[model samples]
Target chain A: MPVSNSLRSLLPVLILLVLFALVPLLSPSNRFLSLAISAGINVIALYGLSVLFGQTGILSMGHAALVGIGAYTAAIVARDFNVGFWLSIPLAGIMAAIVAALIGVPSLRVSGHHFVIMTFAFGQLLSIILTNGGDYTGAASGLDVQQPVALFGLSMDVLTHYYLMVVSFVALSAIASWAIINSRYGRTLRAIRENEKLAASLGINVGRHKIGAFVVSGIFAGVSGVLLAYFLRHISPSQFASFPSIYLALMVMIGGARLLLGPLAGGILVAFLPELLNLDPVQSRILYGVCLIAVILLLPNGLIAGIVAGWYRFFDRRPVQPNEPAVEREGK
Target chain B: MDVLLQQILNGLSIASVITLIAVGVTLIFGLTGIINFAHGEFLMVGSIVTWLAVSNGVSFWLAIILAMIVVAVMGFALERGLFRFTLERPTNGFIVSLGLIIVLQHIVILFWNANQKSIPRPLNTVWEIGGVRIASVRVMVIFITAAVVAMTFVAITRSRYGRALRASVEDRDTAALMGIPVRRYITGVFVLGSALAGLGGGLLIALFPITPFTGGTMVMKGFAVALIGGLGNLTGAVVAGLILGIVEGLSAGYGFSGWTDAYSFGLMILVLLFRPNGLFGGTSGPKMA
Candidate 1:
């Protein structure tokens, strides 16, 4: 934990952020920049997911509902209370966290299979409720956010400005996620994930810690949701349905949920892979399904984890334990 | 009173179909420890096949049989090719099933457009009893489901294979050590479960219009029934399914149609909170790890 060691550990993240910062300077087309901005927002949420799935070993199949809650909170607050974008960001996150805690409390009591099913049901329930919300929820056709995000006398209506804002948030999220993963609480979650009974025997409050992980992830999803609302200027219940949750889960799984760079890599790859391949939405989804199966079977940790292990094997000539902490593996 | 009776009858028919799907889900989970998210997709495929067969001039009953066979074969293939590899980790099996949901749904969409498809009702007759009218097709579905459930119950309780399946469900390792072919039993249960879902699908299209996306909603309801009945408990599924169908029927009939789905989800959450092991608490499922 020396200053030099801390800086060394942050080197990769710093390099990655610099590259992200240069995207707009590269003079990419607006369409490409928009896609990058969307991906950046997803990366923010994925970092939260990594802490839950990667560190705590709990996969929430209803994460998109949490995101939807955030998005809807922002829209409602802006419409009803005349809140601005800046205030709505924190408001949305808090709203999502509160809902996450409510669902997580009872859901955490069940076993893994039941938990997954419960979350899936909850996602469906949220969408259905939204669709039946009548005037309050705009009833299914969805709500439009009329207010544009303004910062320090500068309008973020331009694509470049919005992209930078999203990128900065993504960077902040990555740093927060990195800090969490390296903290004592992260290690406790990891210990619980490895062996809940053993961790409980050692005086760890397993249930509280698990719920805490869910809330943390929920906050990330909420912030991502606000960014999405402002970026698209519209939000719908369908966008945050069970399939989107599955989509988010798929990206995290494919990118190596345990790795620090996994979310950024996963977000960009999933967003652009179909475009790059010139495939239709259905075709891309089929490909994703195949990729997920292959990853789970052959590379249980994910794409980046597999590559990192291979790199270590090839260069360092040392056998990396499959369960070795990802940060330590990278630091070495 | 007549409307109440009619709703109750309608509820029974709905419950029958739900029971078929829920029992299949429970059976597979009991033996394999894998919650097949694609089980509803199997049902969808079955309904599609039934529609194809009936449109191509096959008898409705014969078409149902054909669909069951086709889906059973698919179940066997998946068990051998995909699920067999994930036995060591049930969570992996679950993920693979999620993958299967995407693959199967899109494949269906590619072959047949995403529009809703319906089959002609073979029995258009309506029987009126005590001022309550019931469609003959509904009665047929109820009778067929009841017969299937009875047969399944007898098989599990009286037949040699039933005893073996029960033993395996109770303790897979011990069952395997006792000269039981646990692997083959797993395949058998999976295939049987898939076939049951196919039968339910065939019956479902007779009652309602279906699309490629119907699996998502169907699976949710099926899980609700299965879990509420106590996962891995067949009797629990039937009773739970009956209760769910009746409640849904009354709710929709009484002008709460917009929130019919929400009721099921809310009921499921409440059950999970109160009885995490399910209402019947007769799970042969694995211990929480």
Candidate 2:
């Protein structure tokens, strides 16, 4: 049953990949492909956020800073050391993970609101440092990723090829996220999220696990950053500021952070919704704000979770159990 | 000596504005447990109101008052309509405030356009003491802020409502058990905090140019003051605000203007590392569960 459940979960990811594989064949506009590629990169990072916020119940508002660190690391190395995109991927991931662990150490000491505020400050601090990094960080204007990603002896500068590359990465990230969600570490993290004190009492190293989750998320963000840098061919301090961090958090929150398809659903919806509606950037942001508030009020779990629950209720036809405690229902 | 005096005066003025914003932030956090990310927007809205009033021939002083009143009403409405529902889950409240930040900012942008707005300083005279020169506007801001802080300090420490507020902050469940009407206090605190933020915004625009986006940076500084002072501790906020303002003023004056924000944030990170509850220890604030 467990094997089948795992396989069932993988089915949607497979479908998603198959659908992505069809995008190039349809011959969509370069602009559309670019948006898809951007969304795919964001989806990769969102998966990491899912593990941290969804499974571990730790929300790092500085997630974008980690992404920034990865991008900057890749860009700097590529610029100065003649490091190619392939070589910089692991370097970026390791650098982001190290920074994440460093920030997570002191931040994890304070839980709840303080943790949120601290991460927020850290995000701002990273942007400030990058902006003031002078020529080393390329300053406020930012640095260019001159190294193009080459796969199979072909440069992926074409929109279709790049989209395919991003899609493949998305698939790989989704599968890895799924594996993590089903792993023993995932369960332990969920236990910590459910009740830190109880988990601590049950012999869990809650602090270490929280830092581990952050480091893992940082690695994911780092790879996503690499993809983003190469895709855009430019990286800026402003891109990874506190506002962008908030934007990433908004994506995860809207998509249902805990579910397998949440990141994909959220990433696509947020990336496409404004474009599809033809709304300007300001109007779309306002809409996102309203949506976030409404989601929190009406569907606290998230859009995907709410939809899944609705689907279950429609099919199950279970009698109303009024006297059953809310906690017991949650336990089930 | 002259440079030191000038920096001290500048720091005092900066601290005054931060104190107003930080106090409101701490008060709201103390009572409602929401970080109120939109508190900066509340400040922005206040500055907008002040700008509108001043443009329409209202006195700058009256404009500040109008801004505060308008923002206070906004606070009441948001608390009653939106934030009241999220009391059971503070994290949701925080997220809701994040949404509110975006919504409020863009709404301001949609209506007013995202251009920097500035108000003529109400007092343009400079008072020179020895070799040091201080703008009368800065002095006025410092005096006004000091008065407001004193009034708030006295009210919270000595008044009946203040006692109830402190009690609610200490423990919501017990405060309600004691018939303190914690709900009403929460509303009152929210309104007061919003009003203070509005005043801070009004003062902010008087000092510098402001855009709809100014709130982001201001709010970070405000939170730094609030957290460094101790999240819910009023006196701590004032002290932290002073320290932050001085640090920022010194950094800016010493030709490290670009890194002034870095200094404040770095100080905050260090304080958080050493004293997670804030420098003064946030005992007067709600106990973290």
Candidate 3:
């Protein structure tokens, strides 16, 4: 695809992101900011998920474990040593990546349902360890992350944290994801997703690329988890369990994992729906599940594509150029 | 000797419940190829319905029967509304089932509060032999689950519907081409599976305390058992469920209670890694998306 066409393709996403960036300033309320920050963290987290499910074609019901690992790393370090947020946060991502690599290497060999189960078992075991690790993980009830990160000698406040989450977490992820997807690495993952045997036959290091995608995803989850710990200021086993992975899956699907800005849309909806509707946990979870099923049935391609497909149908119009593929950029 | 006997008995009772759930899950997988995570929700609701019916002055046995009918109907509706479209895609079916799980748990919670509820055993007696004491309810659970499994075996081996279902599982398209009403048979498999889940739930209310959240663990163990036994392998599921029950029983009994959950998951992952084809000889068939 041409550069102008690719930029045109990303126009809608850019517009949506510009609107999201202005939300904190426009709303100016702690409650709203909290939701935005939570969504922002999830958006970052689900980027890894998109890479896994959408790009690498692996379903990890254990992605939450990576997040937990990251959060635990940050919380344990900060609580014990009173380390600053910057170092702790990056360390969280690095630790999560390390753990992801460890778990992913062996498990990634198994594809489809078996692979999903492997990750799920891994996630469940990690949760058990965190809950039963006693003083180390603050046990099941959770640990208090009392210290906030300092940026330019500014102790963290809600607004500042929100901005930090957006800039450091979301922007950094988007840039990294953009860079990777644009690089040969991204094309290789998409190739693997489309057909592993064919890609391998074409001289791809299939296993390495798969592990690399997972590690990159783990990094995203770790940073998001670190942000979640700081944002919530309290972390618990319940916060990072199997359900969170499903919840992340819901967001990715709802926003359209195939689209660059899909997680952003998904993140905002999932993070705020409970608070916005004042729904109890049960009701909210039910809603999420219903939403997930609805998405899978009606929007298999994802929310953006589904909506676009519906729009095109309503208009009964094919693309203006029959010879050109609409928005086809070879995984970039 | 008494302790060993006790643990063995304990393991048998738990394995019976697991077999009921696992067989149901594997049955659906065999016929329809959906790993209905909401299958455990049937078990949860079955118990809850039995509790509600029994508390409302119905006879315990009658309530159990009613629960089975109700859940079977619910299973039918879910099959028609949701699972039908997902038959071709196992992954989509999984996501749909996850959705159903969320939906079913919340629906139950909406009607019955999330508080854990325990039902009094219908038999309310203990049988003691050789210094090993056993609750009559436990005996009933084991016996009833055995009867159900035996009946299922007979149905599969002897009955026309069972033959058709088996054929469908063997090769869905061929079964259809050979004039088997494949979709209807698949639906029957789901209803029968759900009924088994209901029966397990009914038995469960007599022996174990339950809440809506209990379905999560039930599904995990059921799915694990189904995998270990091999998907669609009846005998394999039973053996796997028994092994899992014994392992869990011993772990809980021997004071490694905190690690028991981890222990079960470890078993599942190990099976997944070492025996992806399954212990009893069913091949892996989940399609890659």
TM-score of each: 0.95, 0.95, 0.94
Q: Give the DockQ of candidate 1.
A: 0.44
Real A-B contacts recovered, model 3: 0.60
Clashes, model 1? 0
* Residues A1-332, model 2: lDDT tens digits: 28677777778977978888897888899889989999999999999999998888887777899999999999999989999988898999999999989888975567665677788889999999999999999999999988878888998888889899899989988988898988899999989888888999999999999999989999999999999999899999999997788888888878878878888998999999999999999999999999888887887667877777777688985532211111101111
Model 2 chain A weakest lDDT span, ten residues long: A323-332
lDDT of 2 at A56: 87
Task: Give the candidate number with the greatest DockQ.
Answer: 2
Worst 10 residues of 3 chain A by lDDT: A323-332
Better of 1 and 3 by TM-score: 1
Candidate 2 global TM-score: 0.95
In candidate 1 chain B, what residue range of length 10 has the lowest lDDT sum? Answer: B280-289
The full ranking of all candidates by TM-score, starting with the best, is 2, 1, 3
Point out the worst 10-residue segment of candidate 3 chain B by lDDT. B280-289
Q: Which candidate order results from sorting by DockQ in descending order?
A: 2, 3, 1
Question: What is the clash count of model 3?
Answer: 0
